[model samples]
Target: MKQKIRDILAKHGGLPTPVDQLADDADLYAAGLSSFASVQVMLGIEDAFDVEFPDNRKSFQSIDAITKAVSGLVGSTEAAE
Candidate 1:
């Protein structure tokens, strides 16, 4: 899961530093993640994980936040299935 997040960030983070080198708690916005890129990342994550993001902006703050949010959505979706 972390690897997938890293891959998504690597593809869309727009950071000067590589996404794989970033810590999970790193401030992605501070590391140059733009709003548009984050939206793209969110769409990628939703497609990859087969989950829908709720209408919450804070869900994409950092890699850790996104991981937790995705885990929750995946968990609930699996439970429902």
Candidate 2:
């Protein structure tokens, strides 16, 4: 899941720094993730995971946060499966 998120970020993050070079807790915005790019990343994640992020949940600051969010969504989806 972490690698999947990294792949999405690598494609959409628009960060000046390489996604692979970032630590899990690194602040993406600080690394040059623009707001528009973040949205693209969010959409990519949703498409990859087959899950929708809640409008109220605004937590995509770092790789770890995204991993946690995807884990929760995937866990529930798997339970339903």
Candidate 3:
């Protein structure tokens, strides 16, 4: 899961460093994520996870927020199974 998130961020975020090296709680905006990049990140995450993000996803403010939301999404999926 973490690897997938990292790959998405790297693929869409255009970060200078590897995505894993980044702190999950780090401010992505401060870390170099542009507004457009955030949208691409969202799309990447949705595709990678095969999860359709609702409008709520737009509220996430940082990598940690995204991580937590995605984790919960996976957890719910697993629980539902």
Candidate 3 global CA lDDT score: 0.73
Task: For residues 1-81, write the lDDT of model 3, one tens digit per residue.
Answer: 656676788899877666777887777777788788878988898887777667663434666687677877767654232
Per candidate, the number of residue pairs that clash is 0, 0, 0
TM-scores for all candidates: the values are: 0.87, 0.87, 0.74
**Candidate 2, residues 1-81: lDDT per residue as tens digits?**
788899999999988899999999998888998888888998999999898888523558899888888878889644332
What do the candidate models score in CA lDDT, each in turn? 0.83, 0.85, 0.73
Tens digit of per-residue lDDT, candidate 1, span 10-69:
887678999878889888888888888888898998888888898776888788898889
Collision pairs in model 1: none
Residue 62 in candidate 2 has what lDDT? 91
Q: How much is 74 displaced in model 1, in angstroms?
A: 0.2
- Estimate the TM-score for candidate 2: 0.87
Judged by whole-model lDDT over C-alpha atoms, candidate 1 comes out at: 0.83
Residues forming the 10-long window of minimal summed lDDT in candidate 1: 72-81
